[model samples]
Target: MNFYNIVRVSVVAALLGTSCLPAAAVSPPPARTSAVTNEDERLLALFRDDQRREQAIDPLGMLYRTGKSDPALLRQVFTDNPVRALNKSVKLSLSALKKIDRAKLSPERQISYDVFLYDKTEEAFWLRPDMLALTQVTPLDHFGGLHIQFPSLMAKGSAVSYDNVADYEDALAVDRAFPFVLDNAVVRFRQGLDSGVVTSRLTTANMIAQIDGLLAQPIEDSPFYSPVRDFPDTVPMSERTRLQKAYFAAIRDEIYPAYRRLRAFLNDEYLPAAREQVGILGMKGGPGLYRHLIEQQTTLPLEPEAIYQLGLSEVARIQREMDVVRKEMGYGEGDLRSFFDTMRSDPKFHPKTKEELANGFSAVGHRVDELVPLFFNHVPRTKLLIQPYPAYREKYEAGGSYNQGAPDGSRPGIFFYNTYDLPSRFLTGIDTLYLHEGAPGHHFQISLAQENTALPDFQRFGGNNAYVEGWALYAETLGYEMGFYKDPMQHWGTLDDEMLRAMRLVVDTGIHFKGWTRDQAIDYMLSNSGMGRSDATAEVERYIAWPGQALGYKIGALTIQRLRKKAETELGPKFDIRAFHDQVLMSGALPLPILEAKIDRWIASQKG
Candidate 1:
């Protein structure tokens, strides 16, 4: 989820299990004369049942926070028989979904029903035997590898709670299963080989590098040991010593051995068989697979060519805007490419050191914090923290990202900027980056949604790619209205980030659906924007690793922008920015079409 997770959410979750529903587990709703109200309680209870079942399958996800959960202290991450679970879970959920009478539901209930149906339908499409053949085999990739994610989970003061002795024991239990989880990935990879389903040699090489990086640290010096180095005084001395010994043993005996096994298999076998081709379309049943992935990510039935063209137009439009700023800076008359080259090479645009970059982002964050009230009526209670990406993941990650905090506000939301290559990190774009990854973007949207208790559990904690990233991208545009991008360079900085999203639309789709090579994507990006070769390469590889994902940011941002224009036009002077924003944010991460419908309803009501 780290890199591949950026703005995208899957419509089709690979839910699998062969269990029949227990309809009577939940009681029916209170009596209602209307058809909508009559079924709301009964159906919602069933919905809750299904959600809990899904959560139960993902115990590690459930225990991601620092403390207690419904099924507390469980350590295993992957669901049981995950590959086979897809068919079984989808068939059952889809069957259950079909039984619900959507026509009987009220407007609000109807939205819930439709959202559920959308997810189930997409899941049904992918779980079909042919498509599943393409997906089930390819269990791990460079971007979302557990090989990279698990250690972070085990690292001290992280997600897995270390508040109590039981928590410590739970950590051990989870650690014991780490080897099985890695071995399961191996099992899936072997299965993929039999079916001619293999990942790119490029991604495989990255995974190998990742595995080696994890192994490079000595057992005592490992991140997994960081959490235990200082136990709370509450933990008894003898028990603390026991945990210390057990952790060392787990790393030495269990965790390391599993990684070594995976590393050996990857280098010796997987690499040799890994495909030279990058896109998923080249694989067996890849056309259908790629199409479904696009649909699942974008929540629209858009063709790849249409999206590619949209990218080109957006890129051109943003470039024109950039030209205005360039001219203002007294460089517009000169060659556009040379100006871009200067921006790329100019040391003045970049931070001299990591601390300077961090402090710059923090300063921008402080300025934005004072400006939040001017734009929005609602601000999230959750705090935002700016930090650099960890040493291990910085190589694979983008320039910046955000991870949502606990809904309870127990954990502060973190905005991680990549400090991997310090010199290439630009100071001009820091304001835009902070806005996108921090307040009024991810922090505002994500925190507001998670904090809204009126929404259903899925809506609160769950998401869609369009509304989430779209809203964040849209938030950047608000910087101009809020007067933060007053500097010609700062305004261009926003445009610079906007151009990258536009480029993603072109490059991501081109690489995946149109058979554009990695270098083509990189070259196009370098030519169009101020991105250095390293940044271009990382972005292209990311698009390759996760197809159709980059399309979401621009596609989503445009949709929100269009909706705002419509609302302002229809409501005239009566349109309230506060209410309009609330209308968008209060319902959590709606699918784009659903979001549009809700905005239409809000507009009509405001007009009345």
Candidate 2:
């Protein structure tokens, strides 16, 4: 994964709206409101212009590591204070909305109004009084810490120049962009290092061990490795070698040392100060932090308890369905747990090689494409490609992921299959996986958003996990409707995948929020989903490393299912699945509530 892509991931996390605005609509700001004076409007305009320029120049700032560290440029970019600019922009937007005579606005403006309302509501979650102070403190600390720790990599130098850096700066900037959240992460990282809970020596030893393990084998010998024998032609020869050398050196020197320091700090200092209690409920300003994350990720005011309860309900409901599916397959005599065990161990389901894995993915795309017309009329013009995971990040990416292409059509939307462990890439679930990760799922929805020029820049490339992932999850079910899941065994794969997601809801919260140990979380996943122990452990660790993310998949899927059901009941015979799907995709990715509202309006239109 490019570093910039990581930052894009974080920004996508913050924006929560995952659709691109149409290019034609990327124009000047709208007229000023009467409630706000010309001066305010002028200030707002300046801010918007400056920010837009910054966005256009470096949309994924700090995340694009070209390996060239120019301190002067870095200082200039960070010095302007984006938070202040964003604050002013948010205020001006709200003022304009307030001044609007809602009844007088044209229908098109009304759509903007609806979008603005959603944006305002979501922003409030991030700027809540309790969170503002901490949020501000955190980003500064992260920036300061990174600068201090990796001065060689981040300082002004030939090495840190654009040509040499990796794009991961975007991910780093995500924390920087939101100081409050970044501050918390820094505090957590530091604390984890300080209290002897995680010793520097141990972390260094582990990292070195991992690195050595990586170096011990020839690149071709590891299934996970993809050798980048030559740099892209886009990069000059001299710059490419320089960057490659700098990148490796930084990893060996700066990053490794920083990791060691952080580990020591966590082991010696932070953990001792760390609270024993679990969940966002017990931390200082816990309620506000939780609210901020919810708003930041989901674009809603839903309380943590409400989400937790929803997870519980979803788990029970899905489990019951699993039971029924098991019985239908003549496994009723065995427990669901035992049934999953049999399903996972069945050798008939496993793919044998990298080519087979890629071919399986391609086959799924072909099959799903045929079925898409059954449920969607406004299918995306964007193409989808199934490829193997890139070498550098295969260890970290999920089993498979859908990478949306650049808006200007520079790249095709890529569905990267992790052929790193081919056996793990089973054939049983390939069709459903393709549907969720490729057509009519992430690729379709995200690409449509990117293509929508009418949306604001903030909305165009933004993503809310619940909405985006939910839609994908919902897309999984479309397999049944499309008549693609003809094999009972394949249907079992769908259930297994669904069960894995449901189990994530239970285990993620259990580990991070409920104080369940890592092992405890792993055990729950293994026992519930029949996933191999290694995969289960990796997943549990991922949840710990990235809190609240796992909840999005199952939660989002359920919301879509609920909305579709509501549409069916209300529209009766009038409900057209294709039209309904079009409405969902055309509106772009929204917060769950906004999505429901949009769907309801669509249902009303159909009824009339």
Best by TM-score: 1
* Location of the lowest summed lDDT over 10 successive residues in candidate 1: 17-26
Q: Quote the lDDT for 304 in model 1.
A: 85
Please provide the root mean square deviation of candidate 1 (C-alpha atoms, Å): 4.0
Q: Give the total clashing residue pairs for model 2.
A: 62
Residue-level lDDT of model 2, residues 1-608, one tens digit each, is 10111113222122221111211113345454454444444433433553453343232232222232223323322222444444555665676566656555543344445665666555554554444443332221111123221321232221123322243233233222322322334453443334322212222233333334334444333211111234445556666555545444444444444445544544455545555543434445544554556545555555566676776776677677778777877776879888767766767667777787788777777877776677777766667778776553455456777656655444467776676666555677777777778777888888787666655444455546777788888888988877776677678678778877888777765754566776687787777665666567656655553446667777778778988899999988888888888777765667677677778777878888
Task: Kindly report which residue stretches of model 1 are placed more than 4 angstroms away from their true locations once superposed.
Answer: 1-36, 65-89
Give the top-scoring candidate (lDDT).
1
Q: Write the per-residue lDDT of candidate 1 for residues 1-608, one digit (tens) a residue.
A: 21214422111221211101111111223235454476676567657766655554554445443333332213222333443543466567777767778777777777777777776576567567676567656666676556776677577745566877988887777777768767767877887898888888888898899888879988877878876789887788889888899999988998899999999999999999988878767777666667767776778888888989999998999888888888887785676677888988989887788989888888888888888787789999887888887787888878888876767787787888998877677777888888888888988887897676655666666666766778888989988987878888788889889999999888887888888888888889989988767778888887776667677788888999999999999888998888888888987778899889999988887778
Task: Give the TM-score (vs. native) of candidate 2.
Answer: 0.73
TM-score of each: 0.92, 0.73
